[model samples]
Target: MEHRRLGDSGLAVSEIAYGNWLTHADGAACVAAALDAGVTTFHTAAAWAEGAAEEALGAALAGARRDDLVLCTGVFWPEGAGPNAAGLSRKHLRASLHGSLRRLGTDHVDVYQLLRFDYRTPLDETFLALSDLVRQGKVLYVGTAEWTADQLAQASAAARRFDVPLIANQPHYSMLWRVAEAQVMPVCAREGIGQFASVALAQGVLTGKYRPGHVPPGSRAAAGGEARRSVWPLLMPDLLDRVGLLRGVADDAGLTMAQLALAWALQHDTVASVITGASTPAQVVENAKASGISLDLDVLTRIDQLLGSFVQTDPRLTWSPPATG
Candidate 1:
């Protein structure tokens, strides 16, 4: 596994990070496979599986060397019914960091991120809280997910003022979904913010498992989960047809469709890591191989030709604070 510095930070992360967003149930096996495959970065979130994901990961990494790994988790999603149980307020931030630490069975996370920007919270309060966590030795660095470019600028300024280690950004990026390419990528590059590319496989759409006219058995969409449901609209027949066209490109390179897609995401200079998840040890091994593959200009042009006009590159698709009831 190739390691890269996360933005301008001193911390080094594997190019391919093992994530457990949807496969929290296969935590131990998947984590072991990743570690065996030379993967040193592991990402999870407190909101995943209502915290079961962290527990499972903690158990899986119990015997690993703490200083040698980059373990990341995040806040900003509800952990309970209380009004203050979520968001980026100081109270919630403090509480969430502690909770994440307890679940991960670690003193501190390598990078503690805000899962989403909270428009309702004051930037001062949020930065101050994050700084405090650094001072308290609960979090080494702070990051954001799905934050707009303007928000990143403000946060970057606040982090500097507060001396908080704001080192990375997590956003959805894939061949099929280019929402982060427009504004977010440029701002992050300018700010020296490393990007942890999420949904790099476009919710498995880039895996080429979903046929144009038939839903494969035991696939993510066929499994019928909330994550799959959220991205179902992108699984149209036309989209699949375009995806099939890319298979020829992958075949020419002697790579699987998944590896080709992952390599494309890693091709971006601003991308520090491409986050991938798997439900089995075999899948974990397969995904890790993408880190070794690199795409050239000709292959990229071929991909663009095959997927022309079908890619979703709208920057307006960025996430926002959920409306209160």
Candidate 2:
């Protein structure tokens, strides 16, 4: 797999990172496939499956050389019923890190991220807490996911003041979602933060499996609840029709629609990795192939022309939930 330095950090990560979000149940087989396919970075979160994902991944990677893998996990989600169960508060961050380490069977995570900006917590408190983890050798690097440009600027300044190594940001970036490109990317580019683009496949919409009127059996959309809710909006008939037209572009480029979509996300210089999740080993192997593939300028132009007006580019679309504290 091709490796790139995460932002200005010296840590190198596989261009394709395997994340266990909705697919944690398949962690053993999928993690095996990813490792075999030369994938070194594995991402998970304490909130995923209520920490089961971390346990499964830790078990899956038990025998692998620790030095050769890059394990990433996140905080800032409600993990319990207590008032301190969520947010980036120092107490919760420390408690969360210890729990994550115990579950992942690792002493320290390569990258520890804030799943969202906690409006209730002081930014300084959050950064100081993260910096403490670094000092304690529990976390090597700190990052954020789904944070807006202004939040990133504030965090960037705090990171410098606290001397924390804030090296990455996870954003829901994809061909159909270009909100990050407008503001987040520029801020991150200036702040020396690389992006681990999630939802690069638009929750499987860009894969062309969800047709205009049909949702494939055993698909994420078919499995109702959170999966269905997350992908439902992207299942618009018009959007699916536009996604269907991209098959020709993928065919012409000798790539699967998924690969085309993933490669498109990797095309950005600010994107250090495209975080992909898989329910099967085959899916893991297939996504690994997009690691080093490069789309030509013409292919990119064709994608834009084909997906024109269907794309969501409002910077305001980047958001986080209000603090209920």
Candidate 3:
């Protein structure tokens, strides 16, 4: 797998990162399989499964040389009682990082990201707390997940003011979710920060698996009781037709929709990495295959037209335009 310096930071991470936001219950083998396949970067959050994910990841990576892989972890979600247990306060960050360290079986983490913006806390305090982590040697670099363009700019300013390196961002960017394109992407490009695009497959919908009468047994739609089916709910005929058109594009390229989906995002020079959450090893390998493939202009233009077949005012997405064509 190809590796890149995360954002402008000196640290390097695999283009595809193994994420375990679900099903850490039996993840050691899965994580090991991913590591064996050259997926050396792992991303997890403190809120996933109420601390169980970090514990599971810790057990999974135990004894592996630290330099062999990069462990990316996060904080900023409510884990328990009391106000101090959540948000970007120094107290919670300290508590969470210590907890994460113990769970990941490491003295320090390669990257410690805030899961999202904490409006309750002042940007100054949150930025400083993260800065302090870097200064104290507990966190190699500080990053934010799902942060807006404004937040990124403010945080960048804070990093400059404090001399802390805000190196990366984690955001939802897929054929199904493209809000980042409207702002976040440009900010990262201008700021010299890495954009780690997560859910690049859009919960497997962009894989072209769900059909008019079929819901693949192993898909995330069936992983649990997912309410949001594909962006085009199977019940909607027009959207299903659009999906078929998208699949034809993938077929012509000899790539699965999933691969094309990831490739489209990786096409961005600003994207530092794409973190894919997989419940199985096969998925890990499939995601890794998308790393270096670049979609041609004609296909990308068709993808836009295909997606443009539907429009909604929800503002949850920004239907991807042909980045190449």
Best candidate, TM-score-wise?
Answer: 2
lDDT of 2 at 242: 86
**Candidate ordering by TM-score (highest first):** 2, 1, 3
Q: Which candidate achieves the best lDDT against the true structure?
A: 2
Identify the superior model by TM-score, candidate 1 or candidate 2: 2
Q: Summarize candidate 2's per-residue lDDT along 207-302 as a digit string, tens digits.
A: 889997898999989997899899998888988888999999999999999999999999999999999999889999999999899899999999
Lowest summed lDDT window (length 10), candidate 2: 20-29
Q: What does candidate 3's lDDT look like per residue over 39-71, in tens digits?
A: 888998887888888888888888578878788
Candidate 1 residue spans exceeding 4 A from truth: 23-25, 323-325
Error of 2 at 178 (Å): 0.6
lDDT of 2 at 194: 98
Misplaced by over 4 Å in model 3 are: 24-26, 223-237, 309-325
What are the clashing pairs of model 2? Answer: none
Please give the distance, in angstroms, between residue 117's alpha carbon in candidate 3 and its true position after superposition.
0.9
Error of 1 at 259 (Å): 0.4
